[model samples]
Target: MKKNLNFLMGAVLLMATVLFASCNAEDDFLVSPVDSTGAVTRSVTTDPYVIDFANVPAAYTASDKYGANLYTGGAGQITEGYKVQLGNSGTYVQFPVNYLEQEWGEEPRPWQYDYWNGGLAVSDYTDITDGTYLNQCSVYNGGIAGVDNDKFVVAYGYSDFYNDPLSTYDKCAKIYLTDATGYTVVEEGTPVEGTVKTGTFNSVYVCNTTYSQIVMRDGNSFTTGGKSLEEQEGWFKVEFIGFASSDTSVAPTGKVTYYLANFDKSKEEESGLHGEIRTGWNQVDLTDLGTGVHMVVVNFVGSDKSDYGLNTPAYCALDNLSISL
Candidate 1:
């Protein structure tokens, strides 16, 4: 009887140990949607090259104008550098070096006639629903098509906050985009009669249920770059592009240019994005000018421009900056 009692107690202890182990494993594997700082967090990589973008509290909306020296670099004197912003659209958007404060839910507070005049537009100017509508606007935080990065900064070509190339948020990092992973797009395969297509992204296939194009699961839509299936037939459409130059002499001067993106394109269009950003970590090479590059500025411009204003939002995303100091 004594032996049997001891056996029973041992069995109970083993079961308890298993349960405790399982619970600990689950806790370690959990991925939080919003980071502890409440700011959106992207690729949780231990890569050494990644920038030192620290998270601020959600209420921190402080922003600075451009043209000031950016990097303090632990030295009392300001180090000559620019803060690199990665457009969720895959373009490089630059802010004043002082604009380094990466905050969460930072709304577009315009400083000009049409910077972020969301209420001025017939509809919400910030509305990028149709891919075409958000011209000259600003794209803030986003969750994209695949698990590229949990969160990132987005800036369109014309997204210089004060619209001044001479000054204001004008510097961008030069990066080489080389992979498209987990990129999810939807085709309006056999569109139901009432389905309404929205954004006119190049990757989107507009047709009825009987048409042939990109394949998407029925009754459910795919999500990418911070949006779900774009149209009713194709509710959410997203297009990401990027541009760079070997010339780092100034902002927007590109005698030599480079194209980068994840997806494939038949021909080179005049738009900024070379291709869409893919899922997983991609290999980006930023050596257009070779090593010893002190710094590079992003000159984000777009085709949708006129005297009155520019088109497309000002936003971009960047991470894992590979450079030699």
Candidate 2:
């Protein structure tokens, strides 16, 4: 009997030891440094490059009379030539700009216009539903007119703020320009890129002379060298590229949240203009962007909880906004 008991005790001890070893192996796997194989993933460790507001060019700092106020209610007017509508229930109005004719004389080129009823018209402008419409206005006589006239009408759709006013995120979109030289501009059809998971959406616009405009997910937008008397001459659209995420576990879902920086009201008031302008990183998702030969724009949309206004108006700044693989 004593011999049998000893054997049983020994077996139990051996089983316990095996179980403990298995647990230790799992712990080591969790903490081990990942191999640098192409298959093995790594996080973006390099700190994002921040823009030096002091380095802003004189052209970027110039005042823009055409700069539109975003907070105005109902079919807000953008400069003397453009009008914007707010809300979900409304008729689609055509936009007529003389600049189109001045740029492409006698030739009727395809022009894309963004409609923001509920939120800013970003890349999702193509996803216009019954409640929202981002219609392309036909060009005539090389130029579309109707700034002081009623030829163009502004429309609106459902207001995200009405449903949830306390929400931190705001739905917005922007257009940018890009040319053969790989210079991106803030123009029509600029691709919007970013991740809108849970609540936060941030993105950076790489501001370069090669690039023209930095359209925000919010209704407000900016140009690099300020506004020129010749409009369409310097404006074009950027193609869609991809984005990178700081956290790999939370894979981006081709959506983004809204963040406003650089322009502070108190600071703007302190200065002669609206506010001091600063530049920082704008976070985004790059899942949609494929490899090589593409431009990108970032947009943010969601329930309205944040204010879209700058006490100081300034050009948009961007850095390290690129796609790899």
- List TM-score per model, in order: 0.31, 0.22
RMSD of each: 19.5, 22.9
lDDT of each: 0.26, 0.24
**Alpha-carbon lDDT of model 2:** 0.24
Residue range 1-325, candidate 2, lDDT tens digits = 9999999999999999999897544221111112232323333212221211222222222122121222133234332122111111111111111111112336554322212212121110111111111122110111321221112111112213443243311112221111112111246433222222111112334221111112221222233333321221221111222223322233333433222322334433322323221222233343344322122223322111225321111122232232222
Off by over 4 Å in 2: 1-56, 62-288, 304-325
On a 0 to 100 scale, what is the lDDT of residue 145 in model 1?
16
**lDDT of model 2 at position 235:** 18
lDDT of 1: 0.26
Report how far off residue 191 is in candidate 1 (Å): 54
lDDT of 1 by residue, 60-108 (tens): 1112111011222322212111232221222221222222222234564
